[model samples]
Target: MYPEPVWTEWEDPDDFAEAFQLHVERHGENVYRLHKAITAQGFKIDPQTLYTWKRGDKEPRSATGLRVLKAIERRYRLPDGYFSSKLAHSGRMITGGGLEKLSVVERRRLAWHLPDNFDLLPRAKRAEILAWVRTVIISGATDYRRYHANAVLHRFSFRFSEGASPLPFPKPRPLEERLADEGAPEVGRPVQTERAPIILDTEARDLRLFKTATLTTGGRGRNGVWNDETANQKMEHLGLLFGALAACPEGEVRGYGAPVRCMTFAVLLFPAVWDWYLRWREIKRGFFTRWESEMLTVVAGLTRQGTGWLRQSPHLAGYLRPIAGLITPADIVAATEDWDGVCETIHRHAIVRAKEVDRVARVHRDPFEPILTILEADSPLGEYRKISEEVRRRRPDRRRFPVAAAEATRGYLMIRMGLHLGLRQKNLRQLLVVPRGRSPTPERQLEALKRGELRWSDRDGGWEVFVPAVAFKNAGSTFFRKSPLRLILPDLSGLYDEIDVWLRLDRKALLKTQPDPRTFFVKTVKNKSNSGAYEQHKFYEAWRSIIQRYGIYNPYTGRGAIEGLLPHGPHNVRDVLATHVLKQTGSYEQASYAIQDTPDTIAEHYGRFLPQDKAALVAQVLNQVWGS
Candidate 1:
């Protein structure tokens, strides 16, 4: 029997078996010698009982076998209750979820190279290959043989820490589901994750694809420059999308987050299913011809016409269908036909789950109150009151080419634009200070804004910034909007003065070398000829910098350098907008239009009143009840 605290907390016999397997290592397939070695450790269990325990068929209910199991755990060098964590006290990892989270490349390396009990192996020696996956886009690795999968994994650094994905990974659970012997069940509280998966400096890795695109097409390939540019960006977004899918947790549609198996399986098997369909139809072969044939037949038989797919397997076709190709949208309602009404249920749950985990940790319950107070100080053109004037000042440095002051002013302007406009991150980032038709130097752009009139060729004389349809995320979806979005900036009196000073002094310093840039927000590059116009990531970085300055941007999980920084990211700024608008106007539709979100979405996420607001209303009603 096992000693105390080793496998004592285990709820499932199978769990104990897996943990035991961790100790059964390098027996070199010698069962008799392995059993003898385990028995020598002071617990005497015959091979027969050990086999049953390994198979999880026979549970040691009585105290009779505890010492033997503990012997196996200690012999294997596993920590106490290595696989079973009922009270959530142990630190040893017993589940495959962490391994599963590694990209497709890492999973293959672990599965193919590592032993069954590799967790027991010297920790450093495992992972014979360095990287899991080298490529960003989903490769043809799902094909039958997974040709060159190892080669791909070997080329890149596939670090499998929680930081690999941008979205939050699901909380860890025991390998086998367990029910306590007594009292109410414990659904465990949310634990702070070790590292945030989302990385802000994603552009460095992501932008490489665009460089390749430019080299391949010279300008735009056959599709034209703009069209090709859009397509390339879509390819870049897939890495993050896969990470989001990876982040989904597992469990019931009602109480728990999306299941990990349910999530990864949904994507992993998606392309595999298509390959499966092709092999069945004799269009393409997988792994090898014969293995592919047998695997296909087994899968087809499982979904055989009369056997009832839902009855035999619990896998939801709806979830799989959406992700299967990753080429187009999945049919949600169709996926649920056999899902026992769980497809819609889980989909909805995933949405809500995604939102909660994605929220910034430091965001105040009333995010707007802090922002409003900051905005009210009448310092849009000046430095924040909290910081000393010596550190950062509103006054523009009149020095020739004042780089520091210029960049600071630009950052200040960008943050104010985000708050005042209540614009979505994407929209806010794409804003044009100078119309595309005009040469957009800092001076020219500032002149345009201060001119007090719309100066673009496409519109009237007032200050209206028009965003093209192609720029919208929902441009293809008819339900969301009619594009060619128009934004009217509210007339904050000192706005022109801020822009004018930035143009004449601060921004003017940066723009001294490069002239005739097209975008208002220009990055300072050493190159005199290039203004580094349209440097997209700066807008995001600027928003985050100002938020950090306020000391309000808190990440739920920790991250490294600026590249690893998630810091609620720019999207949460929209949440701030929604809450503020809803609080002031009490109109979901108005708030939605202001933020360019659907009313339903606004209501769903931000409609709930703040506790303070609710208490005030309740107090008011009570006062009325007392006949004021």
Candidate 2:
């Protein structure tokens, strides 16, 4: 039997060099003898290489390095993966073995999944491994995933410069001048199509004013100010609208070739323009969608009677000019004289248009498609927990891979906390964090800010969450009744330990020197531009990324937890919670409590408990009588 080597201070070796040296000492072997033994076994290794490993100069990473380690392990009579497991704890990814042929991105992605002896494998075997990894792990082969992949390839949107001023409309050029301009150049220059028009300074200023007016409180006849999220949504919606208008009919967007230079806020005054845009959307998508309906609603808000910014700004009508097919000079003159009447007409038209679009609107994307596997389960909550488990299992060594470790911890908490709270994305992203010793944020302050907080509850003797009713989207619902939500978090699955680590070390590591947004979750701070706050879109992406990495099981790699799982955002957690409650209690009211919603809402939207599922539940109790 190989005897354990006595250390000077009795500290166990962790790095490869110390461990290798200790094993060598235990076997009464030196570097020369190990080198000779390895060479004799048809594995070529230098004596100096063993010396370097002993001196802790470098640890094994490549296939050859692994082979040498295995030979040393064999010489010492140690268990398989003994040295490699120790190397894993070193924090550097074991790569560069069979991955020489792959790109930098591919190597990084495949490093965790690939075996140490990957390079020693046959060419055919390597190809098979690469193919499987790419298909299952790198590129998910789901039908909707395929659709998304293909959809992003065609970029149709245009970006407008905010600084550019409106140029004077060019008069018709003489026929000879036009012909001469049209003539091909003699040089090797590439021919270019007509460029998209730059947004004028006036046009940019109008948009800024419109957004400001909408966001400002208590404007004349104004209903309410838009929140930050709503304001952003409007900005994006209008950007797409104008981008489509400027797009060429012959191009990928296949839009009506309205001259962007001639188009201004005045275009919103004409009913013909809105109708054309609606029809274009319908034709492009091959059916009416909720997008068109929502867009119509936005237009209605923009041109509403007394409160409408466009209704008040009659001067914008003068900026309108004639386009070849879309607009006429006569339309501009008419709009300038009766801007308020034009606004009233467009406002009414939008309302009517919205209803029409809604009647025929088809559901383009199924909200439940990505999470069908989780929802169809008897215990959806239990099924979804597998993702959190996968994250915990794959958590990198904190000592070696601090950033990756922090990210893994963050991902794990995101899944765990989401399942527990069943809160919407906005609430989850904006949930403030207060450390255990710190005073919890007051209920009044939280209500004023329309946000929530996670803090230690000294009275309850556990971690607690307090969310003001006003912070919720459904604050007026019967569920709240003006009462705030308060829950003491049970310390399940080492939750407290993980949370402590996150608050003390991982959170600080992720934030670095960046100004903390004080949210429970923080983005991995890589640069000055990264504010460490989770915006709506970025937060959704982070959740989806977690699902992609840990939730979706790859049969080839055997890494992820769940089978048949697709990438999903945090919102799907509500469906899982609702469906789980419904299955267990067979009470819609009870299910609604899980998601802080109403029974009717759960039945209509969240819970997918069909008639057959209900019948099966009843049948289970009835069948027990016969068995007895």
Candidate 3:
């Protein structure tokens, strides 16, 4: 059966008011004029109604109401997606576009066209022109009608060529007159002037008007003067020009919108510009470098005359007194040398400090005897036997049941297997206890135990457990390809018999509920939810509690909890496996291959042996090896 679609309309005056206020504030005075213009154009609504609609005071009455809303949208020159119901669903308000609509290709073409006619205007006028250009570019206006207004304004305000010749203004002239103009002498054509001649004062004074205007616009004459507004205007002009250049195809601007977009543009473009300037030192006969160096020298002179370092600091710039000493070439060289030395010294100090920090942070706080020492202990296994015997002695009384007896037994067996196999936690979690071959009852416990496979090859015709890489951390790498671990047992048949008895006695109930017959780890009476497994944290806790209750402490360090247990919640079991493997093999390469630790790291950290007593370790390993 088909269901009917449902829709709901929403209205909120306060939200609308707030949204409108924010829009006005961000777009500035022009927004108010736009609002007035829209109202005066004679829509059947009052200005207040329009305001209320914009503020969310009223929902659009119908689809026709949406057309009115679209009119307001056009006035603000909003982005394509603005005012759509999608904004309502997404909980965002409509606002004027901060010029993010342009495509990458369009922006590149705009940038290429800019440098040709950029220089011949007053700072404020230049800023206005660039701002309009930015708007046109962002609006994606490729057609003449869409961008013609801005282009006309820009051409009217600035000379398009070096001779101060005006740009050609489009007019309704006759075709015959235009053709006659095209036949004029070529000698009067405007020349393209490079920056070098102007900088060197080789060109006539009138030809240097653009550079002179820049300085004057910033309120600094040949003798220097204070004009705050001029400085601001010049800065605004430079920002616009740089921003436009950065938007060009060659520039590396990223992202969209104001502030962050501008910052992204600067982050990408500035490095490229700096790199090019550096390289130009060789190719351009050092002209660019010399000019930059001279500019820096002038700045340094101004900074040093009265302020010194305090005056030169960015924080105190406006507060500093003017100075007059010129920075010499020797001074520049010396400063560079000092900076390099300081940086080198700081880097060396950082390395030393990091080592000191690491030494202090490496505190391991476990309260258990090391497993090796416990295994080596003269009567470690005997202690367990004694405890079991005592519990048996008091078995007539149910209250005398051994505390954590099941957990202690299970944890001891699991840890022994982990130490032997170096299996990671994920693989251990998914391990099952199923019979090998055609036996009705399970024989051997296999890993990577996929369904229906009684046995599979382990690479070299040896019996092994296959483990998949997805169970490993670096599963994507080809280095640790799906491999098998040899199932080498001292008495394989006897081991299988013991496992069969354990499963029959301990996990019979849990096995009944599972639909799949191939699963290995059956739920036991001790773990009620026994759908074949426990969480990693629960397993760690069980191990920790058992070790603590047993009072097992390492003989060498006198610590009791697992060797490297940390409160990183769980997952240290994997590390324990890795550490034990490394200790046994005495070869990082072997340990890495067995435990999935990178061979490179193993070589770096555990490659060499420390001066520890061999006697205590060998005895402990032997005792623990047989689970005595």
At residue 193, candidate 2 shows an lDDT of: 26
List residue ranges in candidate 3 displaced over 4 A: 1-409, 438-464, 476-479, 482-494, 509-519, 522-530, 551-585, 603-628
lDDT per prediction? 0.40, 0.74, 0.35
What TM-score, over all chains together, does every model reach?
0.37, 0.80, 0.30
Q: Residue by residue across 92-130, what tens digits does model 1's lDDT show?
A: 222242465666654552232222343444545444321
Which predicted model would earn the best lDDT? 2
> Which runs in model 1 stand beyond 4 Å of their true positions?
1-396, 435-462, 476-483, 504-506, 527-531, 549-568, 605-608, 615-628
Q: Candidate 3's residue-wise lDDT over 221-276, tens digit each?
A: 23332232333333333233323222222212210111111111111112233233
- On TM-score, the candidate that comes out on top is 2
The 10 consecutive residues of candidate 2 with the worst lDDT sum are: 182-191
After superposition, which runs of candidate 2 have C-alpha atoms over 4 Å from their true positions?
1-60, 63-103, 113-139, 142-144, 151-219, 307-309, 527-530, 624-628
Q: How badly does each model clash, as a count of residue pairs?
A: 31, 0, 23
lDDT of 2 at 398: 81
